[model samples]
Target: MSEQFHAFQTEGEGTGSLVKRTVEDLPQGEVLIKVHYSGVNYKDGLALHKKAKIAKDYPMIPGIDLAGTVEHSDSPDFSKGQQVICTSYDLGTAHDGGYSQYARVPAAWVVSLPDNLSLKESMIIGTAGFTAALSIHRLEQNGLTPEDKPILVTGASGGVGSMAVDMLSGRGYHVTASTGRLEEEAYLKKLGAEEVVGREDVTPEKIRPLDKQKWAAAVDPTGGKVLAAILSNVKQHGSVAVSGLTAGVEVPTTVMPFILRGVDLLGIDSAYCPMPLRKEVWSRCAGSLKPRHMEETATEISLNGLQQALNDILESKIRGRVIVNLQK
Candidate 1:
C-alpha cells in the first residue's frame, strides 16, 4: 500500500494543480504531520506567480505555515499525536509545505504549539501574526513604548499590518493605521486603531532627506516609498520595523533620519528567526501579546478554496488573515 495525500503542486515552469501525491514522494524529513490548519501568506501567493522566483524548486507546495497533530516522529523532542506548528524557514519554499492534508517537516523546523492556542487559532496567528509580534518585540526592545506619540502601521488592512495594529493597541499604544483601503476605516478602528489614514498620507509626494518627526515609531510591511517616508518621519530616537516589499522595492531617501534624528531601522524576519526567540515569541502570542480580536482577524477556508484566496492576496484584496483548514 502507498501513502497518498492531497496537495497543491506547482511546477517551476509556472503552473499549479491539485493532485494526489504519495508520502514517498515528499522531501526528506523526520516528522509526518496530520495538518489540521494552514495559512495563506503573501509569499504563498507569489509562489504561484510565474516570475516571482519565490519557490526554490519545482513541484512545491507553498503554504509557509501549518498547525497539526504529529502522525509520526523520529525525533525524541516530539511525540506522536502531539500538537505542533511548522512555519517559514524553507517549509513552503525549498521543501514540501503545509498545503497538503499531510506534511512532512524536519524536526528542527517544528515547534510545539503554544498551550493557549488551538490549531485553528495557531494558524490564525500564522506567519503574518508571527512577523507582527516579532516586529513589536523588536520595537519595544529598541525602547519604544506607548507614549503620547502614536505608532504608525503601514498596509494596516492586510494580515501583518492588521495584526500589528491589534497587538499594539492591545498593549496600550496609540495606533495610526495607514492603508490605501479607506473603506476599512471602521474595521481598523474596531481593531483599536486610534486613527486610520490613507496610504498616501504616509507616502511622500517626493523623497525628502528628512521630514518633520510625527510618529514615535512605525511598523511598516509596505517597503518602498512608504518605508522611506516612515524613515524620515519617525521621531528622534524612534524606530521603524520593516518586513515586506508590497510596494516598489527602491527606497529613494537620504540618511538624515538615522544620523540626525537618531532613528533606528529594524528588520523583521520571522522566517529564519532563532529557535529560542521563536519559542519565546510564540509563548507571548499565547499569553500577554495575544490580541483581543484574533477571531475577528481571521477567516477559515477549505483546501479547495485556496486558488481564490491566493489570487485575492496577490491583488491585496484580502483583509486580515485567511486560515486554511486541511481535509483528509
Candidate 2:
C-alpha cells in the first residue's frame, strides 16, 4: 500500500472546503518532494472564494509556494535528498500543490535552492518576495534608477510591498512606503523605507488627467482606484510595476499619464513566467536583493493552522508572511 500523508485538500463545486488528502491521489509527476515549508499568499486566499477563478478544478490544493528536499525523481536533473523550491505555474491551481506533507511536481517547475538560503528561508521569502524582485527587475529594465528621485511602494505592510521597500532600499533607491496600517510606520521604516506615508497620501479623492509629478517610479501590489491615482501623479518618463489586485481588478483612469508623460505601466505575473527568468530572480533573492531581518517578516504556523491563516489573509488582518510548517 502507498504510504498516506496529510494534505490540506479543497473539494466539491463552489469554493472547496478544507479537507485532508493522501499522496497516492496526487497527479503523476517527475519529482516527489518532502515539503518542509509552505507560504500563504493573497492568491491562495482567493482560491478559497467560490468565484475566485484561481483554481481551475475542484479537489485542488491552494498553496502557491513551497520549499523542500527531494524524496524521489524520474528526471536526472533532480535527485533524492536535494533541496529545491517551487512556486506559481500550475502548483496550487490545476495540480496538487504545497499544502501537504509531500508534493510531486514536474521537474521543469523545480529550482534548486540557491547557495546561502535554507529551505525555511526560501519559503519565508516565498512567492511574495519573488514577485517583489520581479517588479524591481522590470522597473530597472524600463530605465528606473536610484538617481531618479524617490521610488514609491504601495501596500507596504503586506508581503510583496514590504519586500519591495526593503529590496529597493538595499539597492540604494530611496523608497517611500504607503499603507493603511499607520501602526506599521515604524516597522516599514525598519525595513529600509526612507519615508512612510498613510494610504490616503497616495489615494486621491479626485483623479485628474494629470497631477503634480511625485514619484520617479512605483511598485504597486494594490491595483484599483489607487493605481489610477498613482498613474496620474507619476513623474515624467517614470514607470509603475503592478502585480496584484487586492483593491479590486478594475482600474479607472485616463491616458494622459502615458500619452503626455510617457509613464509605462508594467504588469508582473510570477506564475507562468519563463524558467530562465524565474531562476535569475530567485538567485537575486538569495544574493544582493535579499532583505535584511527576513525572519521578522514571517509568522510560522502548522498544517492544521491553515484555515485561520487563510481567513486572516482574506480579511487582510494578517501582516507580513505566514509560513506553514509541515513537520508541526
Candidate 3:
C-alpha cells in the first residue's frame, strides 16, 4: 500500500479542509520531497478563498513556497537526501503543493538549498523574500544605488515589505517603510527601516500627475492608489519594482512619471520567473541579501493551525512571515 499522509485539500466549498492523502495521490512529477517547512504568503491566503480564483482547480494545495529534503528523484540532478526548495511555477496552484507532509514536484521547479541556510531558514524567507530580492535586483539593474536618496518599501509590516526593508538596509541603503499599522513602527525600524510612515501619508487625497519628487526608488508590494502615489513622487530617472496587488488590481496613474521624468514601473512576476534568475535570486537571499531579522520576522505554526493563519493573512492581521512546520 502507498504511504498515507495528511494534507490540506480544498474541495467544493470556501477554503479546503484537511484530508488524508497518499504518495499515489500527488500529481505527476520527477521529484518527491519530504516537506519540512512551508511559508504562508498573501497569495496562499488568496488561494484559500474560493472566490479569489487563484487556483486553477479544486482539491489543490495552497502553499506557494516550500523547503525540504529530497525523498526520491527520477532526475540525476537531485539525489535522495539532498536539501532543496520549491516555489513559484504551478506547484501550489495547479499541482500538489507544500501544505502536506510530503510533496512531489517537477525537477525543474526545484533549487538546491544554498550553503549556510537551513531548511527552516529557507522557508522563513520563502517566496516573499524571493520577490523582495527580485525587486531590489531589478531596481539595481536600472541604476539604483545606496547613495541615492531614501528607498521606499510599502506594506512594511508584511512579508515582502518586511524582507525588502531588512535586505535593503543591510545593503547600506537608507530605507523608508510605509504601513497602515502605525503600531508596528518600532517593529519596522527593528528590521532596519531608517524611517517609518503611516499608509495615509503615502496615499494622498488627490494624486497629481507629477507630485513632488520624494524617493529615489521604491519596492512596492501594495499596488493601487499607493502605487499610483509612489510613482507620482519618485525622483527623476528612478524606478519602482511592483510585485503585488493587495491594495487593488486597478492602478490610477498617468504617463507623466514615465514620459516626463523617465521613471520606470517594472513589473515583478515571481511566478514563472526563469529558472536561471530564480536560482540567482535565491543565492542572494541565502547570502548578502538575507534578512538579518529573519527569525524575528517569522511566526511558526503547525499544520493544524493553517486555517486560522490563512484567515488572518487575508484580514491583514498577520505580521512578518508565517512558517508551517510539518513535523509538528
The model with the greatest TM-score is 3
- Candidate 2, 117-151: lDDT as tens digits: 89998988899999999999989989987898689
Model 3: CA > 4 A from native: none
Query: Candidate 2 — which residues are off by over 4 angstroms?
Result: 12-20
Query: Could you tell me how far off, in angstroms, the CA of residue 8 lies in candidate 3 after the best superposition?
Result: 1.0
lDDT of 2: 0.89
Q: Which stretches of candidate 1 lie over 4 Å from their true place?
A: 1-3, 12-15
C-alpha TM-score for every candidate: 0.97, 0.96, 0.98
**Cα lDDT, model 3, residue 246:** 88
Cα displacement (Å) at residue 256, model 1: 0.3
Worst ten in a row by lDDT for model 3: 9-18
Candidate 1 C-alpha error for residue 273, in Å: 0.5
* Cα lDDT of model 1 by residue, 1-328, tens digit: 2767788878755446789988787788999898999999999989986589898777788889999999889999999999999999999988978999888889999999998888888888899999999999999988887874699999999999999999999999999999999999999999999999998888868868888889899999989999998988888999999999999789887889988999899989999999999999999989877877988889888877888898899899999999988963
TM-score of predicted structure 2: 0.96
